[model samples]
Target: MAGKGFGRWTVHGDGRGLAPGAVVAPDERLSWPATIGIGAQHVVAMFGATFLVPLLTGFPPATTLFFSAIGTVLFLIITAGRVPSYLGSSFALIAPITAATASDGMSSALGGVVAVGALLAIVGLVVHFAGARWIDIVMPPIVTGAIVALIGLNLAPTAWTNVQAAPFTALVTIAAIVLITVLFRGILGRLSILLGVLVGYATAWIRDEVDTSKIGEAAWFGLPEFTTPTFEPALLGLFLPVVLVLVAENVGHVKSVSAMTGQNLDDVTGRALFADGLSTVLAGAGGGSGTTTYAENIGVMAATRVYSTAAYLVAAVVAFALSMSPKFGEVIATIPTGVLGGAATVLYGMIGTLGVRIWVQNRVDFSDPVNLNTAAIAIVIGIANYTWVIGETRFEGIALGSAAAIIIYHVMRQIARARGTSQEAASPASAPAGTELNRGEPQH
Candidate 1:
C-alpha cells in the first residue's frame, strides 16, 4: 500500500487490519446502477451549460456534446485518473467565441479557442514546474478578482436582455431557482440549479414557448459533422486579442479546481491543460465552438464532496452516447433561452461572488491605497474600455474587460511600488516575507 498524499489516493485493506505496504485491489463500490444514476445527475446538472455556447455562437449543439465528452475523458486520463475534475462546456469562452464569430465565421472562432486552450496548457506546465506561487505573482487576487467580477458584470446586461423577451417566464424561472435553493435542504438544495432549470423548462412547455417540432425532426442517431480550419488572416487577427483573455479565465478555473481537491495540481497542470487545449482543437475540427472547464461542476464537487474520478468517466461516456443521438441533442436544444436566462441570473451572480470570496480569503485590505487603487481602477477600466481594435480587426465583449483588468492591475501595482519612500523598500530585495516578491515562500 502507498501512503496517502494530498491529491493521490492510497490502496487500503478492507477491514483486514493489514500492515503498511499491504496490497488491496480496487473495488466496484459504484455499482452499475449507482454509476448510471450519479452520471445522469452530473449530465442534468451540466447539460444546459454544455449546449449553451453552441446555441449562442451559432454552432451545432451535437458537436458541442461530442467534444465535451471527449474533453472530459482526456482530462481524466491526463490527470493520472487522480483528480476528479469534470471538463464540460465552459462559459469563459463565450466572449471570445462571440467576438471571433462576429469577425469571422464559426470555424475561425473555434480555431482561436483552440489556440487559447494550447496557451492554457503552456501556462499550466509553467505553473506545474514552477509552483502555484508563480500564478499568484502573475495573476494576483486583485487582478483575478477584478476580471471575474467583470466577467459576471458584463454578462448581466445579456441576462437581463434575454429575460426581457419573456419577463413572466423569466421571473418564474428565477423564483423556481430561489425557492429550491433556499427552501430545500441537503441533496435538493445541492441540486437547486438543475431543479430550477427543470421548473423553467416546464413553464416554457406549458406556455408553448418550447418548439418540440424540431426535436422529432432530428435524426435518432447520426455522426458529428467535422469542419476544417481555413486560417484566414482576418479571423486570426480578430481572435488573437481574445485568446489571452480566455487563457486568463482558464487559469482561474485551474486554481478553483486545485482549491476544491486540496491538491496543488501543479505537477499535472500541464497535462490537464493539454487535455483542455486538445479538446478545443477537437471541438473545432468537429464543427463545434471552444470548450473549457465547467465552473458549475466545481460547485457541485464542493457541495457534494463526491470527488470520484469514476463518476466523471461515467459522465463522459453518457455525454458521448447522447452526442451521437440527434434526437437527444434536439431535446436538450429545446430548453428555452428564457429559462437559461433566469438560471444564469443566479449563476452569473454566483461567479462574481466567488471572485469576492477569493479576495476576502486572501485578506486583501481595500483601505490600503495601493490595494484600493488597483482594484477600483482595474474594474472601472475593464468595463469602460471593454473593446479592442487593431487595423481592420476588432475584438470586443468580455475579452476586452478581462484583458483590461489584467493590464490595469499590473500598472497599478507598478505605480504603488514606484511611489514607495525608500529605494530598498521599493526594490524586490527588501520586500516582506510571504509577499509576491518572494514568490509566496517565507524567507529564512
Candidate 2:
C-alpha cells in the first residue's frame, strides 16, 4: 500500500521537456528534479483556497495544512495511486462550521465535522459495495449542476462584504488575476490565483491594510494545535448538507480525471469518497478543517499536463513541511480582507461557472422543463440566501438549495415521465451547445 503511493511511478520521457499534446500519467513521473518542481507548483496551486477556508472559518491554518497534506497522501493510497488528486480544506463546510461555532462553540463545530465525515464514509462504503449508479440516479446532471452552482452563488454576499472593506485593494486583486491568466501561459497562467493574491497582498500592505504583528509574534516552528470534538446532536442538521456537496465534488473529480486521462476511474470513485471522508474525520480530530479534492490542483495538472501521483505526494510533503512553521501560517493569516475579497469574487464566480460546465459537458437538455425548473428554482433559493430555522437547527441557502434541487428534479422528472411529457417544447431557457450559456468545462 505504501509502495502504491511512493514507489510505482515510471519516468515519463527523458524527465526534461514534455512534448506538445503529451501528458504525464498518474502512475508515471518525470525526473526527480522536474517532478519536485511540479510538486511545488501543486503546492502553490492549492495554497490560496486551502488557506482561505480556515482563515474564513477561524480554524488554525497550520492544522488545516497538516491534515490536507496527510489527506492527499491517504487519497493516493486508498485509490492505489490510480487517481491524481490533492485533498485540501473544503469550502462547503465553512457555513456549517461558522453556525455551529456560534451556537455551541468550536468544539461543537468539530463534532459536526466528525459526524459529516462519518456519514460520508458510510456513503462511500455503500457505494463501494453497490457501485455509484445510485449517485447518478439521485443527482442527474441537472440537479448536480444546480447544486454546484448555487453553493458558489450563495457565497457571493460574503465576497462582497469583504470587498466593501477594501474596495480599491479588491479591484487591484481581481484585475491582477484577470490580467495574469491572459498574459502568461503554462504553469504561471495556472498559478494566477496565488500570484494575484501576492499582488493584492503587496497592494494591501502599501495601503496599510494588513496587520503583521501576529506574524512577528508567532514561533518559527511548532506542531499545529489539536482539538477534541464534542458531538451535539442538535447541531448535526447544520452539517448534513455538506455531505451532499462533498459527494458531488468527489464524484465530479473522478469523472473529470477519467475524461482527461481517458482512463475508467469509476472503480476508484468510492475509494476516493471514503478517503476524503476519512481525511475529514482525522482533520476534525486534529482541529483542522474538513477536506475536499481541490480543483486548483486539477487546473495545475491540466496546465502542466502532469498527473503523476508522485508529484502529489511530494506536494503533500511540502505542505507538511510548511505547516510545521507557525510563522509561515501566521504570514498567511495576515492577508488583508480586501485581498481575500478580491480573490473570492473571482474564485466564487468561477465555481458557479463550473456548474454550467458540468451541464455543457453532459449535454443536459434544459429544454426539458424538469431540468429547467430544477435549476431555476434552486439557483434562486441559493442566490437569494433563503433561510429556514427549526427550533435550534438552521438550514440556510446552500442546504435548502441543495435539497430543493434534488427534490425538484426527482419529483418533476417522475411526474413528467409518468404523464408522457418528458419531451417538452423548446424554450428560451434552453440554449444550444457552444453558445455563451454552454461552452467551458470544469477541469475538476
Candidate 3:
C-alpha cells in the first residue's frame, strides 16, 4: 500500500512508498555532523600512538600531547588543508631515543631528535625544488624496499623483548589482536588493535600487574612541563647516524602520501617538511621526544576511505585536550608494559606485511638476474651486517641496515648496466639479408 509522508519520498523497486520515519542519509559533500563524527574516529584511531611516544621516551606525556596538536595543525595549514598528513610520535626514532636516553638521559636525547627534524626540513626544501625525480635517483625501490623491510625486522626483536617481560600476558594479547583482525570485518577489524590493548590490559590488571599509584598521585590538570635543550657532543654523535636514516625514511613517507592522495606533492613538500621540523623542535623544547608521520594512521585513512582535513584537525584537538590533564596522561601511561608489548607485536608484523605489499604492487620480477642480484644483496647486507662502525662510533639496528641497502643497490645497478651494454656489443649485427647473423635466420 502507498504511504503518505511528511517529507519528500520516492517509490522503491518493490513499489513500496518511502515513509517519513525512514532515516535520511547525509550528503557526502557537505555535512557538518557527519564530518565531525568521521573526524573523531580518526582521533580515536591515533590516540594510542600519540601518547605512547612520551611514555617510552621519559618525556611528559602532556608535553607530547601539546606538540602533537600544534604540529598537526601546522601540517594541515602548510599543506593548504589538502592532503591529510597526520603528524604524531614517530616509531622510526624509537631505537635512537632509547639509546640516547640510556646514555645521556631524556633531555639530551630529545635535543638530538630536534636537530634531526631540522635536518629533515632542509632536505624537504631541496626536494621541493628538485621535484620527486631526485627521490627516485637517490633512493630507488631496492633501497626503499630493503629499508622498509629492515625497519620491521629490527623492531621485531624489541617486540619480543617486551613479550619476555610477561610471557603469558603478551601471548594472550597477541592472540586477541590476530583473532580480532582476522575474524572481524569493517569497523570491528579497524578497532582490533584498541580492543587487543584493552583486553590485555584488563588481564594484566586482574593479575595485579598494573600499578595505579601514579595515576592517583597525578594532578587533575597541569600545564605541560617544558625542558631546555642541553647540548652534548656524545649524544649528538650517537644520534647523527640515525638522523641520516630517518631522512631517507621521511622521503619514503612523502612518496607514499603522494601515491595515496594522487596529488603532485612537490609544491607542498617543503612546507610540510618545515612544519614537521618545527614540530620536532617544539617537542624537544616542551620536554617531548621526536615526531614523525604516523604510517598506521595512513592505513586507517586507506581503510575508512575518509579523506578530509577536518578529521586530522579533530584528532589534533583531542590530543591537545589530553595534554592539559596530567591525570589523563598518567592513566594512559599506566597501561602495563606487557600489554603494549603484545599489541606492538601485531602492529610491527603488519608493518612488515606492508613492505611485502609494496614490493608486490611494484611487480618486482625476482626471476630476472638484475632484480634477483639487487634484492639478494640488499636483503643479506641489510640483515647480516646490520650494524656499522664509523670511526669509534658504532651505529646499530635499522639505521645501519638502511645505509647498507642503499649503498649496495646503487653499486649493483651500476654493475648491471655495464654488463648489459657489454652483452649488446658482443652480439653479432644483422646481415644484408635482413636477419640477425647470430640467430641463423633466413633472408626475407
Candidate 4:
C-alpha cells in the first residue's frame, strides 16, 4: 500500500504463530514481503479460469489479464481497500460473447459487452440506494449454501479426471497440501497451500511434465493486443440479458465473502457490485470480455483465511506484470494438470462446503418443509448443471440453483401466507437478513 490515492497498508510484524487458515481481516496487514507472496498466490488462483475466457471467446488473453489487474486496483480505490476481492474475466458471459462474435465483427460485438457492464453498474446503484435487503430476500442461508455446495459438486468430474490422469503427482500434491495445513503453524501454516503447490510443481518437473517450450518461444516484452469497441445498438440489446447472470454470480460471491470474513458487508456490497460492472466496461472498451468477481480467488481466501486487501493489490501488480510477458505466462502454463487438479480438488471442495457451513451456522430451520425441500432439490439441480434458458437469457449452474432455491422458499412462504392459518411449514428462520452465523471464528 502506497501513495495518497490508495489507503495506507500497515505492515504487521506479528504475522506469525497462527494456524493454517488463520483469520486476517480486510483491515489487517502482513509484512510487505509476505504480502507479495500472498498476492502472487491470488493471481495463480485466478489464472486458470480468467485466461480460459479469452481462449473460448477469442478476446485477447493478455488484455483480460491487464484489465483484471487494473480493474483490481480500481476496485481497491473505489472500496477503499475494505473488500478483498479479485476482478477477472467472467465465465458467465462466455456464451454471450461467443454468440456475439459469430458474425465475425468483434469490435461491434464488444459494444454489446459494454452495455452489459452498464447494466451491472445499474444493479449496484440499485443495491446502494435500496440497501442490501434485496440480497437477503434473494439469497438466504439455505439458498446460498445450496448454490455454494453445487459449485464444488459440478466441478467434481473435472477434478476427478485431472487427478486420475496423473495419479501419482496428484496424490503427491494433495499430500503436501494436507500435511502442511495440518502440521505447520504461524506463517508456515498460513502459506501451506502455496508451499504445497511449489512442492507439487517440483514433483511435476521430476516427472518431466513441466514443458518449457512455450516459454522459450515467447518474447520478453510486449503489450497485449488491444482493440477499441464499436458501439452498436442492436447488439447492445442482445447482450443486456447477461446482466442477470452477472447479478447471480456476483451476489453469491459477495455473500460468500461476507460469510467467510464474518463481516456484515451489506454496505460495501454496492461498492463491490459497481466496481465489477465498471471493470467490465473498462475491459470491454479495450476489447476484453466483461469482468466479474472470481470465485477462484474466494476459494483461495477461504483456504488461506487471509483476506487482506494488500494481498489483492499484490495480485493485481503481479497480474499486470505477467500480462506484459508472454514468457512468464508460458512458465505459468508449465504448471501441470496434476498440480492444479489436486489443488483445485481441495479448494473447490472447500468452497462448496461453505454453503453447508452457512446452513449450520445460521441454524436454518431444516424441519420446515419449505426450507428442507428448497435446499434438497436445489442442490441436486445445481450439481447436475441445470439451466433455465429463456430467449437470449440463460441461467445455469450455481445461478440456476440460487434462483430456484430463492423462488421456492418464497413461494412456499406465500402459499403459507395465503392459507393464513398454517403450521404446514415450520417457523421461518430466526436470523435477521445478512446474518453472520458464527462470530470470531476463522472459516476453514
Q: Rank the candidates by lDDT, best first.
A: 2, 4, 1, 3
* Model 1 residue 262 lDDT score: 40
* Tens digits of lDDT, candidate 2, 1-444: 122454588888777666656778888998887788778767766776788888889998888999999999988988899888899998878878988898888999999999888999998999888987677677666776787677668878978998999999999999998898778765456456668878999999999998988988888999988888999998888888789878867876765565456565666778899999999999998899999887666556655667899889999998998899988767766788888788778766865776676677666776677888999999999999897877655666867888899899888877887899886532222112223333464222
Q: Sort the candidates on TM-score, descending order.
A: 4, 2, 1, 3
Which scores greater on TM-score, model 2 or model 3? 2
Error of 1 at 179 (Å): 2.7
Which portions of model 1 miss their true places by more than 4 Å? 1-52, 81-120, 130-132, 233-235, 259-263, 266-268, 296-311, 380-385, 421-444
Report clash pairs, candidate 2. Answer: none
**Per-prediction TM-score, please?**
0.77, 0.81, 0.74, 0.90
Instruction: List runs of model 4 lying over 4 Å from the truth.
Output: 1-6, 16-22, 232-238, 388-394, 420-444
Clashing pairs in model 1?
A: 1-21
Instruction: List model 1 lDDT by residue over 167-186, tens digit each.
Output: 77888988987887667654
Identify the leading candidate in terms of lDDT: 2
Candidate 3 residue lDDT tens string, 92-208: 566667777787787777788777777777776776677655556656554556555556555666667788888888888878877876676544554466677778888999888
Give a tens-digit lDDT track for model 4, residues 1-444.
212235575555476444444577777778777777778778777887788789889888988899999999988888777778899888777766776788647887677778888888988999888987777666777777776677667666667777887888889988998898778667666676788889999998999988787788899888998898887676665578667667766666766776777666667677788888899999989978788877778878877788888899889988898899988887887788888888878777887887787687666668777788888888887778787777655666766766678789888878967887346533222222333333533222
Candidate scoring better on TM-score of 3 and 4: 4
lDDT of 1 at 265: 45
Q: Worst 10-residue stretch by lDDT in candidate 2?
A: 426-435
